[model samples]
Target: MWISWMIIAVMVGIECVEAGLNTLTKVAMTSGMSDFVFVVYSNSLALLFLLPSTLIYHRIFLLGLLSCTAQILLYTGIGFSSPTVASAMTGLIPAFTFVLALITRMEKLDLKVKSSQAKSIGTIVSIVGAYIVIFYQGPPIMFSQSLPILHSPSESPLSNWIIGGFLLATSSFVISVLYIVQTWIIKDYPAEMVVTLIARVFVAILSAIIALIVESDPKAWTLRPDMELVTIVYSAFLMVTIRSVIHAWACRTKGPVFVTTFRPLGMVFAVFMGVTFLKDTLHVGSVIGAIIIALGLYSVMWGKAKEVEIIENSFICRINSSSEEVPLLQNKSIDV
Candidate 1:
């Protein structure tokens, strides 16, 4: 039970880190860093940062390959799609993880119970709330000239929103697979730092090669002494190595469902951060959507907590019942 609480606490920390990751990455990308190039640099730098771990427990290479593939697919999909599509698709992760977990027996789906029902409903509510945030951008109640400075000088107008949406949705699904795969792979490796390092190394190599082939302009890879450098260092060291190790630990301790339930929190952070930092306007839709997302996060947490309590109680009951019968059986054996 105490362990469960610890997992929850750690998950909150992970979510906070993820929020910063999103914000920082956005700021860097907005500064004219190509997404593919950024991916390669961050992953590569992360590899360098975590090379020590790789030296200690390096074995499997296939897992690293899958990790790289997933990363490539994810960023590529996001490049093609809009952020709204990406978020909406990400909302599908809990559902996808739930289903995948059940199939792999990583999660038990006892739908007859109230806890299970709450989980199911929580996932749905979270997705709906996310869509609300993404779809309904009402009038700006607060405009910021300083923060929420959303400047996309790089992106051109998308002619095919549908295509972009599909791409992003696909990326979201790939992310779900990535989660499950990571969970499975880590079980065998059992070294979170080593696992993260190995994956990052593989991903870095692949991303760099791809970047070279696709990006003809040599100037694209140029590292400026601005947000780009900051993002690269921060993402490599903090985001990849440290943050990923923590997240992988949480995933191993809890289940993927628990890790994914915080997806909605990203929107919460984005809304607030946009208004405060990016000089963006706060809309009514954002307010309402934030509320809904909050509710959904609560529901998931409640359901998981309830489920944990039930399991602990059952375990205690078994131990007590076994102890009680132990003396009785001993007396009978002595008489015999």
Candidate 2:
């Protein structure tokens, strides 16, 4: 139980870091720096820091490749979309993951199983909720009688912003796949070493390529002291590496489900930050949509717990039966 709590706490912390990073990135875009430049520098620096340890683990290349692709899609998406829209779309990740798992036969759908049915229903409901949030801009209801907060210049909708948000959501789905693959591969490697190496090397190469294509002035690569640099470094090192390590440790001690179930905690943190720091406004529709999303998340989690309990009970029964059989055999030998 203690371990479970630790996992939840770590997941929550990671979510907070993610939210804060999003906020920082939004601010950076509002400034003169292009998303391409931001990605190049931040990832390049991260790669530099991670190279030594990654090589030591001998998994720098593979992990780097996967991480690079994920980052490119994600950063590009952020460059194109508002952080609020991007973050909300991320709620679709679990749904995407479930579909992928089914396609890959990593999980199965059994209509007869209550847990399975619940998971399927919950996933569908969550998807519907996301669409409602995204497209259903109905008449605004009064939440707190507050005016809507204005977005920064960068955050203002370009013709491509909607496309970018969709792309970002897709990027997140792809990254989740990479995560699943990493889990399979990391069985033979250290998580820290693998993650660090990938962040450092692979992403650096990818970002450099993007910089060349996107930035008009090659001089954008020149380093200058600013809040963006600080934010990037903090995000790359502390948020990406350090917090990830902590979360991995907690997940190992507890379980993946426990960690994953706490994902919504970050949403709460993001909302608070959005309101206070970014000065985002809330409407009744958005509020109601959030509540629905939360309920859907809970339903999915409950289904997962029930499934785990069933598996554990079956294993316990098997062990007990095996033990009883061994004792009976010994007694028969003694009597003979």
Q: Estimated TM-score per prediction?
A: 0.89, 0.83
Candidate that would win on TM-score: 1
Residue 43, model 1, lDDT? 87
TM-score of 2: 0.83
Once fitted onto the true fold, the runs of candidate 1 whose alpha carbons sit more than 4 angstroms away are 1-3, 59-62, 73-88, 146-160
Per-residue alpha-carbon lDDT of candidate 1 for residues 202-226, written as tens digits (9 for 90 to 100): 7788788888888888899999999
Cα lDDT computed for each candidate against the true fold: 0.73, 0.63
- Give the alpha carbon lDDT tens digit for every residue of 1-336 in model 2: 565455556666787888788777767765655667776677666665566655554445655566666666766776677666666666666666666667766567798999888777776666566555555646654333222343543545676686787688777677556555554455445465565555456667876886797777966776557766876787778765666566445434433333444444444555557666766555455555667666776777678778878989999999999998998999999999
- In model 2, residue pairs whose N, Cα or C atoms come closer than 3 Å (at least 3 residues apart or on different chains), thus clashing, are 47-200, 64-198
**Candidate 2 stretches greater than 4 Å from native:** 47-55, 60-62, 136-158, 243-269
